[model samples]
Target: MTCKALREGGAQVLAWDDNPDTRINAQSDGVALTDLDRADWSEVRALIVSPGVPLTHPEPHRLVRLAREKNVPVIGDIELFAQAMAALPAERRPSIVGITGTNGKSTTTALIGHILKKAGRDVRVGGNIGEAILGLSPPRAKTVFVIELSSYQLDLVQTLRCDIAIWLNLTPDHLDRHGDMAGYKAAKFRIFSNQTSEDAAIVGVDDDHSAGVMTRLKASQRQSVVAVSSGRSLGHGVYALGGKVFDALGRSPRAILDLKEAVSLPGAHNAQNIAAAYAACIRLGLLPEGIADAIRSFPGLAHRLELVGTHKGVRYVNDSKATNAEATAKALASYNHIYWIAGGRKKEGGIGALAPFFPRIEKAYLIGEAADEFAATLSGTVPNEVAGTLETALDLAARDAAAGARDTPVILLSPACASFDQFRDFEHRGDMFRTLVRARIGNA
Candidate 1:
């Protein structure tokens, strides 16, 4: 996408990949593949590397180090888009809503985009979620870009200034890339860089780390801060308490929407996402009533708590986006009788933190590399079995859920670990689950 954008921008694009197959594919796609060893460094304007390519922690990528040695500016796609947006005239500059967090970033980004688009705004949503930032429609008058930025992309971006920057609760993620929590937090804080007092900064106060971030931003008093939460109430900002959505961003408090009526936006985690999105749309000049209506009509994202199908008295939810314990916790908390399928590449700290929600699980079917370890963790705590694969796990879970006494038994695939163990990625895993569930329960 970056290559295509560069070509469209009228630059002679030169591309190379570490993998020979990727290089061949790039060449096949009309990208100019260059042998870096023989290329002239003086002729290269800037090195636009992918966010996955390391820049600092665990030592920078060899190409990154080489670029530094050549005194070339190294940046990611977001930086390129930012530069392009900056080049536009002031009146034609599009507003940006940058969302960053360990979890729920994709959902929040999609929701904001959906709301803005439904309200008839020219909106383009892409960053770490759907499309590369540069691949989206170019900057124009009355346009808004709701981008989901990961820490890696944030680490590489410098000049991008968001009109509405949301720091949704931070957790320990991408530790290898950032080295530690402090480093990770520092990388995420870059999303707020270059913002003025006229802009708005929405911060989630649900977790201690994010609360601390909110504290610092408040002390600065440079940008308007909307401290959002799903668990508790604040003097000002947006939040949901006891299934009620509150709007105190304007301090003219009002109960906008009851979360009970919001069938798609389930769980407290989503509530936090809602609070942040509501604050952003309101700041962007959308009416409170309209924002709430759009949120209700939101079809929701693909893999995050998505109810793919329902079989004989059982509901199947595909939450493959729950790549860690923190994410899986949301899925577990959302339902009552959960026949949960969990396990993949077990993340650090395992599922120990999810002990509180064990009682909600009717039974757990584990799969992939972390199956045995997860089963051991669930031993004497929650009734669980090592089912070994998603197909088997879903089969067992659906059968057991259908026979269960509960009014609405839920077969949930909220793997609280990485998906690289048994599938290509989370999307592939979720897609397989949806396919299998549909196959098992035909026509329904």
Candidate 2:
């Protein structure tokens, strides 16, 4: 898309990929193929690299180093879109809401866009979830762009400024890409950069890193900042506690919504998502009651604690998106008497960090490359079996959960590892899990 846009702007596009197959595909799509190694670096305007490509990790890509040497700005697709938006007339440009964090970013981005759409506003949502930023319709004055940004995308962004910026809680993730936790936090912090005093910033203060960000932002007073929390009541912000959502931005707290009946949104992580979404929309001038109404009716994102079906008195959930221990912890806490199916390509800390939630799992069915490691993590704490493959794990979990003593034994697939060991991606893994569950125990 970036290449197409650049070519459409009358620039002679030169594209290359390390993989010969990728180069062939690009050439077939009308992108002029060039051997970047032999191409003149001085003639290039800018090098638009994918977010996945390392700018400076174990070692920066050779092209990146060359681009740097030639003083060519290396950026990602998000940055390219931002530059395009900047070129547009100010009065005709759209307002943007940028969301970033280690978790809950997708949910919050979708929730904010959903609320705006329900309020009869012209809204387009993309960037890091459903579609690429450049693939969305051209921005108009009345149109609002709600974007979910990853840390990698954030690193390449410079001039982009969101009218409403939201930073949800952060945890250790993609450390190899960013180098360390501090570097990771710095990348997430870029969401608040380039903001003006007129703009608004909504931050989740539940985690230590996020709380520190809120404190620093408050101290600077550069933007209209609001602190949101799902665990406790704050003096002046949106908060959720005891299944009730509160608007505490006044002299007294006011209840706006209740999540006790929101089946799609379960657990405190979602509560934080709701609080952030509510605060952002309210700041953007949407009515509190309208926001609450939209949130109530909004169908949640799939593959994140998605309730597949209930069969034979057992419930099935597909949370394949939880590719880290922190995310898996949230899913584990949302249910009791859980028949957990976990394991995949291992992560840094493995499942050792989830030791606290072991008591809630009635039994665990492990699979993929991380099975042995996960089994060791749960050895004396939670009863576990190395099922080796997702197919076998799902079958075992379904049968065991059905025969369990608990009235509503929940069979959950919240693997705390990447799906690359056995599947293409998290979505593929989730689809297979859903298919298996439906075949084994007919969908409700």
RMSD of each: 1.2, 1.2
| Worst 10-residue lDDT window, candidate 2 | 435-444
Tens-place lDDT per residue, model 2, 213-287, is 999999988899899998999999999998899999879999999887567899999999999999989888899
**Full-model lDDT for every candidate:** 0.91, 0.90
Candidate 1 deviant stretches above 4 angstroms: none
After best superposition, candidate 2 residue 89: deviation in angstroms?
1.7
* Candidate 2 Cα outliers beyond 4 Å, as residue runs: none
TM-score for predicted model 2 compared with the true structure: 0.98
